[model samples]
Target: MRNSRIPFVKYLIELLIVAFGVFLGIMISTYQNNNRTEKNIKKSIGFIHRELKSNSQKLDKAIAYHYKLKSSFDSIKKELPSDLAMENYYTQQAFRHNKVPHWTGLGMASMDNIAFESAKISGIFQEMDIEEVQAISRAYSYFDSYTKFSENLMEKLLAIDSNSKVADIIVIFEVLGSDIIITEQRVKEEIDKINSQLENINK
Candidate 1:
């Protein structure tokens, strides 16, 4: 009876040892996976940070260029002649170097979104905090809106005839320039918000 009890006790001890080993293995694997995920998150955030910075710089340049262009248009409008024929002639002189000058050489806010798109494709957003994801998404939506707006404006500019009257062309430029400025300002606001959020995240 004593010998039989010893064998049973040995079997029980072996089973307990196996269970402990399995638990330890699971713990180690979980730790490694978590570490890897943290690293990936940091990498993604870094890429996004750089991309946003680049876009902000580009926007600044675009804003400056558009401001100058608007000023030029305003100046031309102020000095335009009252007579239709004279006004057309003056407009022609104003744009003598380039008809459709504003559209032909417009300052475009060609912002990039490759980093953001890549993050989405990689499913990184799933790991990000909901609010953070939302902030980034909101910023990108503004970028997209601005892009579409520019495209439509370009189409309108291209549709204008080369012989269109100066008054007509000036009106188009004034309106479109005003819209572009407003849109750029809104985009700038979103960029500021996203930058603020990024600062908090880094902290």
Candidate 2:
């Protein structure tokens, strides 16, 4: 009696096809995972770039404000006594002096605002060369100088009375204002440089 069932070779061939199909499925799954990982990395980079751009603009504005105040304070200092004399200038003098535009807040946002932001950004892009780190450091250095100047100015303000405090305040403001201006300028440069580097990487 002959075997009427399907041929043994046909059964083996069907089994081989199923195995090949499974292997193909696995390859496809791995390819998709790799693609998804690449997409995630790109998205993260895009987010970082946007944040840097926003921070750069803020830093620019801050720099402008600092310099504007510095220039006005410079004028005010010139108009006031050249030396620290016991004269109640700003208070009693009823001097219709134009308030320094930048001094409206008279609050220091120096390091926390820009330098720290830069540093944080630098951390985000560790793949960058040491030059980027140095650029960030330069920006931070400017901010540090500005903050130190601010601290010393506050000390000077406390050092004197109403009679002498006015001149001291003027000096402090002038120095701080200048430092702020320098910070703004330096940060701007660094931001541009870092952003350029980042752009190259993304591109």
Candidate 3:
């Protein structure tokens, strides 16, 4: 009977050992996966930060251009009726040749979204805080809306009859100038806020 009992004890020990080994393996796997996820989160954040930096620079130029355009429009609008009369051929011709392009369609630079796209596609956004995700989403939404507005404005300007009255053209220019002024300030603030958030994360 003692010999039989000895065999049963040995079997129990083997079963316990196998269970322990499986548990250890599971723990290691979980730890490795968590570490990899942490690294991915950090990498994704860094990528976003770099992309934002490039976007911020683009916005800087855009803001400056818009401001310049606004200034030009304001100056031209003041002289509108007098200039439209075309009493002096040379002066009228000079203004037409020099300022026509400024009043026409100006191209807007597209914002970069490589990192944002990648993060969304690869599930990196899942690792980010809900608030961070919302903030980034909101920023890009504004960018998209602004871009669409610009495109629509260009289309409307282009669609205008070449023989349209100077007063009508001036109205469009004034409207565009107003939009640019508002949009430029909003973009500046958004970029500055995003940059600040990035700096905080780095810290």
126-197, model 2: which lDDT tens digit per residue?
A: 544477456545544655665685576567655655456454556567655765567556766776676676
Instruction: Give the local distance difference test score of model 2.
Output: 0.59
lDDT of 1 by residue, 26-58 (tens): 999999988988787778877887788788888
Ranking by TM-score: 1, 3, 2
Residue 179, model 2: lDDT of 59
* Candidate 3 minimal-lDDT segment of 10 residues: 89-98
Which RMSD does model 1 reach against the true structure?
3.2
Which candidate wins on TM-score? Answer: 1
Highest lDDT model number: 1
Summed over model 3, clashes come to: 0
lDDT against the true structure, per candidate, is: 0.76, 0.59, 0.71
Q: Give per-candidate clash totals.
A: 0, 0, 0
Worst 10 residues of 2 by lDDT: 93-102
Model 2: colliding residue pairs: none
TM-score of model number 2: 0.58
